[model samples]
Target: MHSTRPFLRDLSDSRRKGWEDGLRDGYAEGYFRGQAKVIVERTKTSFPVRKIKVLYVSSGKGFPYSPIDEAIVETLKTLTASVITAETKEPIQKLAEKNRPDLVLALDGMDRPVEQIDAVRALGIKTAIWLTDDPYYTDMTKKIAPHYDYVFTLERNCIEVYRGLGCRNVYYLPFAAYVSHYRPTLTRSAINRKISFIGSAYWNRVEFLRPIIGGLMEKGLKINGLWWDRLPEYKQYPGGIEIGKWMGPIETSEVYSGTKIVINLHRSPFDETVNNNTAKIGALSPNPRTFEISASGTLQLVDSREDLSSFYKPGVEIETFSNSDELMEKVNYYLSHEKERQQIALRALERTFRDHTYNHRLNQLFGYIFK
Candidate 1:
């Protein structure tokens, strides 16, 4: 009655600003404090004087569309005192001899020539190769793995395989997410979809998705990602969104966050019909998307894998489906029950931050190597 609406509006605006400012200040303070702690630790341990010099050989040029390769290089830079990246175009022998790095880390050795690895190893520098595609590159990888000081595989079972290939220092280092890059920070008014799946349209995926896409659309599911350019059917998925172009890791994370459930479908690396050389390794491991989606605090509906239970408690931290029927049933059930879905997502986020991160893997590697 006394025209108090203006006062209420002003109060609301001030409150909004206060919350935003608080979040900004808090983030800045935490970041600096973390840096300060690291510096103090380094000084106490004399780590800077004895800093680990690392040479990171990246596969970015070979896999330009995927951001994970670049992310790995950036993460290594943070973990080491000095990191020199040797791209495919660079002269590896000269760079390694000049830098004389304490360690050389190569990601996916198939993209790199064996001669380059041999050249770097010739400088008496320790070399390690982290293979993302295990048995898929089994033939090529086994040929080059023995040249490295350490052989790290994403598939746990492949440790024996590498050892069988005569690599003595083989280790199991699975794919992980960078927590700082992936988090549930973004907020939205309304969810654009009840479920979502983002990935390239491999022949297996296209075949599996054809019948279910329409049903999923009826239930408000969205699908968007790079599909095979040659397949006109993938170009025009009925009712499903076609991203057309490649999306970076950040964009993928945003899409994961906006959905109620993010589906995790592993691609067949050996589908010869598609002319894709990815081998059907029958590897029992989860890919980077598993950790990335969980770290984003989104409920994930993943396919059943043997190693999944070791990482997360099925029906608790994640939901798994063995077939399309199971997937559809869970999707419908989870959509109707919001609390269960959110709880699983929360548990997964906690697990990811605690165990599944790039920092954790790097620390383990360095500790084992330097010990």
Candidate 2:
């Protein structure tokens, strides 16, 4: 009898790799991907989504981008024969071989399986990478993106940068809200209300918040992020700065819902301490949190960006703050005028849920791929 052990062990090797991946990426992260695959496989029918088999490769090593990866996976599951793995690197080839997906859409090129990308594409798998951190990490993305058949950047400024680097099918695809998770929530938590900001204290942010720190504190501000020590006033307000604490999707959405105004300050691209954009391609697009904050039914007071208006209508659906004084002035006005703030938040929520979501973003991606 020909021993079938070789084939079975080969299959088991893949599962064993999953176990190793689970150890690296915690149990819940592993369960989320594995269980979702199981549930989708058991279903007798799938939605008329793209009608293509896709293998999703995620680079969310955990923190901020993890939820984004999960949202993308949930949307991909609606398609036919979707396989997911956070294992990244070497496993991509083995999984691609087993799954035989028509397209391999990798989220965030920073941590993609660069060496094996050519091999996967050689197997006739159409490769695409939707770059989450653009312009900022161009030093790295510029190298990784050329490996893909299609390149999607969150920053419009990088479209030309990639196109110039010889990536043929470059597209400007900004991040969208994971609507199901980021939708409006009831304000039932111990979170502070007047004003809030959720992101790292990048040197640029540290300096930007310097002038308005006192005013923000007076207005009952609470920040949930890391590296606040960069701010000279870190120890001045114990309750105001949450140094080194990271918030997940659920808690972040809750904070946004509870807060009257959530500040969306972007990290400076030219800051060498934090970014690898040696070429210093300017950033023009809003961050992923812009849609998430609006979808959470909170007034997003984002910093000015050239491409911000294209996605969000400022002063109506959203608000823009150019400098610290302007941001402080708006914060004071919005805090006092509850009706105006609520109206803007509601309008932004309607706009975000209507036009900006992972589903909408994916549809655009598929259109470009098929076209």
Q: Per-residue alpha-carbon lDDT of model 1 for 62-141, expressed as tens digits?
A: 54324656666676766788888887788777888998999988888676778878888888988898887765567677
Tens-place lDDT digits, model 2, residues 1-371? 99755755766777867766756545533333343234223423223566678888887477667898889888777654555564644568778888888888888867655877898988988999998888888888888988999999999898988899899999989989886688665423455477899998898998999988998999999987988988998799898888998888888888887787999999899999878989988988998889999888778999999999998888899999899999999999998776688778877877776688787888788889977
Candidate that scores best on lDDT: 2
Per-residue lDDT, model 2, residue 187, is 24
lDDT scores of the candidates, listed in order: 0.74, 0.81
The model with the greatest TM-score is 2
